[model samples]
Target: MMREILSFCALTALLLTGCTMAPPYSRPEAPIPQDWPSGPAYKDAFSKPDAALAVEVQWRKFFNDHRLQTVIAMALKNNRDLRVAALNVEKARALYRVQRAELFPTLETGISAKKERVKISGTQGMVNLEEYSINLGISSWEIDFFGRIRSLKKRALEEYLASEQGRRSAEILLISEVANAYLTLAADRENLKLARSTLETQQAAYNLIRRRFEVGFAPELDLRQVQTRVDTARVDVARYTELTAQDENALHLLAGSPIPADLLPRELSLVKPLPDVSPGTSSEVLLRRPDILQAEHVLKAANANIGAARAAFFPRISLTSAIGTASGDLSGLFETGSFVWSYAPRIVLPIFDARTRPALEATQVARKIALAQYERSIQIAFRETADALASRGTLGDRMAAQQSLVDATARTYQLSNARYEKGIDIYLNVLDAQRSLYAAQQGLIAIRLAKLVNQVRLYEVLGGGGDASTSPEGL
Candidate 1:
């Protein structure tokens, strides 16, 4: 009958402990436009929004260069920053588990032995006592009568989720950075090649003019002008060489290890542009961006904290109970008559503490701060997507114009060279034409690189090339 009564009381206590003081959660509305920007700047880029394009495009599919793909993979595997972000996620998960464990009793078992002697005066009597016991016990486990433990557990879970989203954000940023660095290195190499070829051409021209002057066929002025052009081209060669080396160093740093020479692009002239990405109209896609999602998680955690603070106004209840056996003789510890048990229930009421009210106020303020941060994240995402789209709209037109300029300049240079050979024009005209052609060619390369880089930026701001449901590594 006694055992049955004890079981009934335990069940009642469990049933009464499930209420929570937390307020209902609703996601804050985004503070940006529902649709992407419209007008001349965005018309060509977002002409028809493919709502599913961003979700479907993966980084590998977007970047077709085998070399570039390999470098990105290496960075993902070896970058120190990304490794730290992944570790942070694991740390937050373990902390959540620790907070969650408070909801359940922790059972512990131990053996104890003691010996004591007492001496009395007068008639003289001395007694020695030995005691031995073994027990299993629960120590000071919170019963959570007012939902304090439950609220804290919910807060911890939200924080863990926030850390996971943070890791995803770091991964996305790293992928974008690696792609940008790779593209920069390729552009620098192409520039270096152009500069070296121009220097050789100028040197050949200078030698021809010097021979003409020596043989009385060309004047000293013509030889001097050609020599100046040669000197300028030499300077360009040196500058470009330095830039290429520096670019390689930057790329190596991003990769976090030395990249094999064969894995780098000898030239990016044949590389294809990244595919276009569509930003959906509902601004719902922004929700999938890891940074925005992380902000929301932090806001949710703050909300849970408010609940915990509110619960502090009520009494906190905890339970400490044990059921085991005790005996004077170690061999008899497990005997039926040696059974022993204890149940302790404690409650703490906050009567006059000065800190409780202020603590609650602090949580309230933190929740407001979180809400503001969440809204700001949405605003920044909208602006970045708009900027990328604007750049995409006009880059194609700019590249076309630059190609025409290069063609026209090349024809002018060829005509001027023929005139100089036939003695119809001075060598100064030939020098001017050559310089114009070289500048146009270099400009064309810059425009092409810009077009390609903008595509990558578009992919990044549109929440990366992969689905938000999975990470770059599919972790």
Candidate 2:
């Protein structure tokens, strides 16, 4: 009969505490326009209709280069920031479990014995008093009649989910960083190679001009001009050498380990092109972004906190119960007639505590703050995707113009050099053509790198070329 009564009470507690005081949650409308902004800058901003969304593509497939894929994998495994984010997810999960466990009673068991000396009423000597008992019980466990504990459990669960989204956001950011670093290093190496090739060409020209001057076939000014070009090329070669070394160091840092020589890119020209990505016509995709989702989860957690705070206003109920057996003699501790049971119920009414009202107000304010943050996250995401689209629209024209300029300059340099060799033109014309050609070539490389990197930026700002649902290695 006692066991039946205890089970009934436990079931009633569970049923009563199931409901929450939290307001219904409806996702806020996206603050951005329905469609991606269209203008001259967004002319070619989108991919084919059939192309997959950036978030649907996996990192391994988006980054097709074998070497780049290997580097990103290594970084994902070793990056400290990503590892910390994963650890935080684990920590939040543990905290949620702790909070959830409070919804049920905690049972404990114990055995105790006591002996003391006492004086008898009419005796001169003292007598020994002995007590022995064994028991099983619960201690001050909350029954949660007003749903305060349940609301807190909900808050903890939302926080755990938020932490998980944060980890996904970290993983996406790290992959893009590693890829960008790799691309930057490749571009710098290409620049170094160009400088070295130019140096070799100028050095050979200087030797030829020197021989001509010795034979009185070329003027002293011609020899000096050729020598100046050679010196300038030498300077560029040294500068780019330094730049390439620094680029490698940055790549190594992003990779979180020393990059193998075989995995390093020799030049941008040799690297494969990155695949194109599509941002669907709707701005709704931003809602699925990990950072945005993380913000929403945080807002939901804040909402849950408000529920907990509101539940504090009415009353708080807790149950402390014990069902056990006890006896004065050790042998009788578990005897038939020694069984006992007790239940103490407590209710705390917040009649005039100064803290309750303030706490509730604080939670309301926090929810507002979280709402603002959630809206701001959407705004920022929209801006990033817009900026990447703007660059994408104009980069193709820029690349074409730069390539044409390089071709024109190369032709001018070839014609001027031939004329100088035939004694029909002065050395200054060749000098000017040589400088123009070098500048145009360097500009072409810059434009090429910009175009490629813009593609990467587009991939990143559209929430990355990876799925958030799947966990990465180490996470």
Candidate 3:
């Protein structure tokens, strides 16, 4: 019956203590819009609002290039930013460990011996005396009460978790960047090839015109017109070649290796294709994005910090105790009588702190600021996901139109050349047709590049790419 009464008292203390402190935290009432902005919603833009996504079907799985996969894998392990992010995780964890240790008692042990000689005439006689003293014991230790120590430990652990999330966010970005860069290089190579092919066509036309002039069938003016077209096309090809080289170099730098001359294929002219991107609704993707997760962790840490700050306003209760033995001789240091120990539970009432109120207020304000930042992160993620979905739709339509235009221009240019050769149209008509085709070709490139680039942007918007080292999971 007595033991049952004791258990009831213990349960009562736990319940009462829990009630005295702030309750478990709930997130703020911030806006989480359920739907995306209207206009150009893809055929299957999203199935549901922002919900957490599975990690397996990441952006890397979107691309089929083996070369790209290899590069991304290597970057994760070697990228400098990823390495630094890893270090940050370690630092936060260590800080949490230190703070956690503070909640428990600290015990230290030491032994000391002292000798003193006293000589004085005031002692009634000249006396030389020697004394040896030794002691060993704990001096001070702290006991936590009033929730201060517990709150501090809790805050530290939350902060550690936040740092871990932050590292994952960095990893996500790194992989995304590498994917975009490689794809850009691929598209640029295709543009360069197109430029070369166009130049070759102009050169053939010029050769035919020059031969007609030699046979006295074409005038100098007609030959010069053909020459002008050839020159312009040649210049364009040269510029694109240089641009492609620069892109290659930049890609190598990001990849952290010497890009093989064949690092990428000579041409990447894919038959028009776009991925079937299912832009999951706002609610579905926003929370899964690494940055948003990191921000939430930060919010938790901030809430814990407020609890710690509030605990500081109350009296601190601590217990300090020590048990040790000391003796005048080295052999007796550990003996039973050569020991001294102390224990105390101190209550330090905060009667005043010229600096405490201001500090406490500052902490409270800082926590509020952190909360705002966390909410903003959520809002930003929501908008990005929506924007990407909308772009994919518009870009797809634009790409289809551009492909038709290129096909039509190519056929028209060929017809004009045939008519000029048969004397049905003037040479100037052929020149005009060729110029139109060249511009149409370039326009097609711009549209195609846009499609690929926007897809990359969409990936980033969803926090989908980058090497694992820089990704949230890798962190």
- Candidate maximizing TM-score: 2
Residues 11-47, model 1: lDDT tens digits: 7477446767888889988888887788888767876
Candidate number with greatest lDDT:
2
Worst 10 residues of 3 by lDDT: 466-475
29: Cα error in model 3, Å? 3.7
What TM-score does structure 1 among the candidates reach?
A: 0.93
Candidate with better TM-score, 1 vs 2:
2
Clashing pairs in 1: none
129-176 per-residue lDDT for model 2 (tens digits): 888777688888867766788789888888888888889888888888
Cα shift from native, residue 359, model 1 (Å): 0.9
Q: Name the lDDT of candidate 1.
A: 0.83
Ranking the candidates on TM-score from highest down gives 2, 1, 3
What pairs collide in candidate 2? none
Best of the two (1, 2) by lDDT: 2
C-alpha lDDT values of all predictions: 0.83, 0.86, 0.68
